[model samples]
Target: MASELPMEEIVRRGARTNFEGLRESSFVPLFLTLWGRQASDDHVRQQLKRHYESVTDHLVGVYADFFESQGWDPRPPFTIRDFAVTLTALVEGLTVRWAVDPDAVPLEMRSVQSSMRVERQDDLDAGPWDLFGIVVLALIPSMTVPRIKRDSELWADHEDVRGLVRRLRETWESMVGLSPPAEAPDHTAPESADHCGAEPRRT
Candidate 1:
């Protein structure tokens, strides 16, 4: 379900859905305890361990594809697999917390706001942001860079305009996981007879 959705929706719905499922499932605690016990149930423990590792590996692949599709490169000291592992851990921890105290990790918590600049009116109109979504949003900046191509217009603009445009586009990418549609035009392709921005040669 998460893989089919856009990044923004994944951040919102993905985390919430996982938390809700884990918190409500009676099998989660049962499995955890069963895996931890040192009784003679070694076979059961090995099966559970393999299952957990398999799930983690699947998540790693999904996340790697998602990040690559969005043209985001990981920052130094972190890899795509690392982000996947972190996300898995985050959901697991949140589930435990929610199981302990539902009120503390409610589906709609107002106190926690992501540091990312909230998208304009669209996000506001979507209704209240949840704690899970906010945490996912906050994690984006530190882990990825907007390595996508810039718009051609950015190259033609003044320095300040270029900077502002770049920053805005980066924020946009972080929020929606989209990149500029086209790359900046090549300026060195043997200047045209009627240079771009130059007076029209009165032919």
Candidate 2:
């Protein structure tokens, strides 16, 4: 994130920088003000509501495909945290690929809304499939998974992105000995049946 400058052009690269430095940047205030207003506005609130509902529906469809592929029944929808994490992972993955392949749509998308002109975002907003925004905004949800995973030690469970498959597999094998409650033997079931018929004659 740091850029080099010749000795003559001294930029203050330090711990406590000046407030004035941010003002020099073109899009900072523009994007913040715009996003601040839009995010809090009633219109934006309605839009966000609709978006969450639609994405929840989308989660259902995605899980349907998932279960179908595995020959398992579709379970209930994800918890909010799970849904958000899954969405972030998908989006961040898109951003990673977008960074490599600079297709016009992807290239125009910036990390923050203020990085570009509002008109530009609006223009790209309606463009074919919103390919840029779809992948760009999609990133918000997909990004935080690995961080939380690392903190919680759940990183070892995933093999797809981090390439920790071998480690994860070893850990899984190590922990696979215990049967779950549902699969564990229920001693009372058969014992109850045996005692039931015999004791019922006395009743």
Candidate 3:
């Protein structure tokens, strides 16, 4: 099914779902213990490795789809594959951490206390943000960059059109946690015409 949710929302939901499972599931630790014991048997260890690798492969595909949907590319610092691996490892580590010290890793953010304001009932039930969601949102900007379509033909030469495009690009960059550089890029430069409009977006 196609998701109408924005990239940030998708990341938030995915992270929270993982956090919920890690925190609430009773069988996870038991399964981990059983899986650990199987590591002593070479044949079982190989099978387990294959299973985990398959799961990682699935996560990679999910990330690929997410990036495509967002018109984003993996930034220079890391590849999409690297992100999938890191996220998987993070979940594993966080699962152990949560089990050991639930107090340290809370499921939701602490409520703000304001003496002047009365709490709304909806606010309590909304469940808008979580620690896992916050962490994922913070990492997204570093992990990916928006695909800026710079071909002159794709953009009209009119000042109004150009200004609108620039604003849109700025908004996109900001959404991904990027700060505008000291100098703005000259999108109209003739030498920069890359025939980008004709080419498929890079993942």
lDDT of 2 at 28: 45
A best-first ranking of the candidates according to their TM-score comes to 3, 1, 2
Question: 42-145, model 2: which lDDT tens digit per residue?
Answer: 78666655755675676556534433343333112323345444543444344445445647334222444343222433223322222433342333223223
Model 1 TM? 0.57
Per-residue CA lDDT of model 1 for 1-203, tens digit only, reads: 22444566556666667767777889778876886773668888788768778887898787777777766676545677777778777877778787788788767755544533235655333334567767877777656655753464333223333354576688788799886679888877888766767887685
lDDT score, candidate 2, position 13 = 19
Against the true structure, what is each candidate's TM-score? 0.57, 0.27, 0.58
Q: How accurate is candidate 1 locally (lDDT)?
A: 0.67
By lDDT, the better pick of 1 and 2 is 1
- lDDT-based ranking, best first? 3, 1, 2
Question: How close to the true structure is residue 179 of candidate 1, measured as C-alpha lDDT?
Answer: 68
Q: Any idea how many clashes model 3 has?
A: 0
Off by over 4 Å in 2: 1-36, 72-85, 92-203
Residues 26-105, candidate 3, lDDT per residue (tens digit)? 85677587688786777767776787788789988988988888777776556888888788777767777878897777
